[model samples]
Target: MLRELPVALYCGAFAGMTSPLVAGSYSFIILAGLMSGIILAISKTSFHGFGGKLGTIAFGGVCCVSLIIYILN
Candidate 1:
């Protein structure tokens, strides 16, 4: 949906910046965006109002990546 575009883009940009490689970053961003969109649509409720879903997704993604790095090192 048009409403979700900005959220997706923002998430994608955040992922790309934090990720190690460009290609992999884009993939991660797209996957995160898709997952977030699906969850938001299915939930039918917003936790923090508009764009909250996307923020949650982005935060989750960052946390996951951080955990991965911590475990790997």
Candidate 2:
């Protein structure tokens, strides 16, 4: 878990930055980080090292954050 932290944080940071471009706010950025961290944390335990899982988590993090933000607004 400790080893994965940097990678997870990097993914969260990437998700946080890109989410704002599509959704347009710091709120979305926060949501993206939260969702990305949670999703990646959950997935890590089950991951089989298939290609692109990290990217997929990043995308899903941004998308879910966008959706949640839209719903809240």
Candidate 3:
């Protein structure tokens, strides 16, 4: 996991930008970070070497959590 630490930090940074309106709780950011970590670990080859890959992953994680929060509400 040492090799993936930077990617994980980037993902966490994305999570930090989430708005209180969407998160609605502190756990939302944590959830997004965890989801992004899982995604980063599994999807290294899925996108190959495209630009914006990190952003795409971050977006996916945030969108996923937003969807979950929506459903739970």
Candidate 3 CA-lDDT value = 0.82
Model 3: per-residue Cα lDDT at residue 68: 82
| Tens-digit lDDT string for candidate 2 (1-73) | 5887898888876786583359687777777878988998788777696887777888898888778767988
Task: Rank by TM-score, highest first.
Answer: 3, 2, 1
Give the Å shift of residue 40 in candidate 1: 8.2
Q: Provide the lDDT at 72 for model 2.
A: 88
Q: Which ten contiguous residues of candidate 2 have the minimum total lDDT?
A: 12-21
Give every collision pair in model 3.
Answer: none
lDDT of 1 by residue, 9-52 (tens): 76545545545542245555565555545554655454655555
On TM-score, the candidate that comes out on top is 3
Error of 2 at 11 (Å): 1.3
TM-score against native, each model: 0.42, 0.78, 0.82
Candidate with the larger TM-score of 2 and 3: 3
In order, what lDDT does every prediction score? 0.56, 0.79, 0.82
Clashing pairs in 1: none
| Candidate achieving higher TM-score, 1 or 2 | 2
